[model samples]
Target: MPHILLVEDDAALAALIVDYLRAKGYQLSHLSRGDEVLPWLRQQRADLLLLDLMLPGLDGFSVCRLVRGISNLPVLMLTARNQHLDQIDGLESGADDYVVKPVEPRVLLARIQALLRRAQPAPLAELTRGQLHLQRSCRRATLGGQPLELTHSEFELLWLLAEHAGQAVSRDTMLQYLRGIEFDGLDRSADVVVSRLRRKLGDHPKSPEKIKTVWCQGYMLLPEVSA
Candidate 1:
């Protein structure tokens, strides 16, 4: 079962969310203040964090930023404000996803599940194919023995592709896997990230051998090329 840490100040809303999520088979830990998050996490392990923007002490953005500095734990921001800027700020601060308040419990649960699925540990300690090596413990990726400088999102994207090497991973699956959000068909965020990751992997946009485009289907990492 995935352990989720919820940092929410609203008592009523928090209770509702906890009840719903617990019923869905997740182990949950709740904290009412943002400042208490890091300290609590240091003492206990949490697979994911559901953070609210408004807090008594530190704000959600600050907490998310601080957590990103120490860990790559996925953060899904819960905000009452529906403003686009708020969502953008949250993502910029290292939040993996954001749920605008008046959100459906089912939607929240689905997001949580997607995030956990992408972050689930593999049977092996590290995964390697040819010159590419990924260290799961440290979330590090190296190509041909050279370290690849990748952001947390980029690393997750690459890891997913590497895991399914030689298979086409659909864009919808990629979006849910990396962002903990559903693809709306119009969202190009996943493509942008893939483009950046391809550049870092030394794959050309016009002729991407490492990460291949499957036309309208999705992207694939060919085992032959990676090996």
Candidate 2:
């Protein structure tokens, strides 16, 4: 059963949501104040979060941002305001999706299911391709038996490629994965980051087998022979 942390101030609404979700076989813990959310989250293992925009003590945006800094847990923002700016703000604040209040219980449940499915971790325990070895739980990667010093972005990029070894990942998809902000102007930036990562990984741009660039598509990480 998927566990969820629900942060909403409205007691009546929260109760209704909790009851509806419990009927769907989901386990949930509730918090009425945003200030309590982070502390509760630290002590609990939740599969997804249901966050309300308005709350006492830190607002939902701050809570969402803080949570994203530590974990990649999926968040669904529920708000009474139905403005485009509100939705944009929620997404920018690290919410996986946004839903306005007065929403159907069934609709919210469907969105929750979708987010849970997407947030599921890859099945592979250890990923190796060429000189790279990635331990998922430890979030550590080594190249040629030496630890590779990588930034957070670099590590995530390598992990995504290594996880899907030999399969081409489109540039658009990679950009979406790396930075939540997606704009056409940022395409060059993504390419630059990938180039720097390739150099750091000691991959040859001329005949790169580790991260192979597919013309007009994206890149692929060729699998290495395990010893």
Candidate 3:
């Protein structure tokens, strides 16, 4: 199910919309304050955001700006303000669409469905090595058939290693690919990331198996299967 994050403070309106959307088959997560949006998104992924114009902690415009800094998730603003200026401001603040409040449930549903259809992600970019699988498009990874929670940096490192499976990928190459910078030899960025990856992948730090160190070149990801 497509997961949506809803940021609305109205108890009655939020409850009514939540029940309706859930019954329509979309997964919904609701929050009351605009300030909570960024933290929630940092820890979890959502397909879309439903924002309210006038929120307690922060207004929808500021919240939308913050979210746009980190993600391109589609945002639909809802509010009692029907002024065209408000709609234009919301759109300029990074919202995909704006709807005035007290809207018919059927129309709201149609707008939501249309937005989701338009925001569908592109083709998946994936790589597999035995029990390890990485979906770069979604930034999701799995190891030993279990989902692995990885940070943005960790996922990028893992994707680079998997892309060049069975061969040593130079630290310089990885650094450039990930951060758009050359490895400084003094930089421990790759080392720190590799350590974190090892722990998450259950590889022994002292005697690692999945990701192994090269004497001088860099690191290598042992191919789990010959296919």
RMSD values for the candidates in order, in angstroms, are 14.6, 14.7, 15.0
Candidate 2 overall Cα lDDT vs. reference?
0.84
Error of 1 at 174 (Å): 32
Better of 2 and 3 by lDDT: 3
What lDDT score is found at residue 180 in candidate 3?
A: 94
- For model 2, how does the per-residue alpha-carbon lDDT over 48-136 read when each residue is reduced to its tens digit? 99999889998999999999989999999997755778788989999999888886998999999999989887577787776678887
Q: After superposition, how far is residue 194 of candidate 3 from its true place, in Å?
A: 40
Error of 3 at 39 (Å): 0.6
Candidate 2 local Cα displacement, residue 47, angstroms? 0.6
Clashes of each: 0, 0, 0
Candidate 2 lands at a TM-score of 0.55
| lDDT tens readout by residue for model 1, 16-56 | 98999999898999999989998998899999999999898
CA lDDT, every prediction? 0.89, 0.84, 0.89
| Per-model TM values vs. the true structure | 0.55, 0.55, 0.55
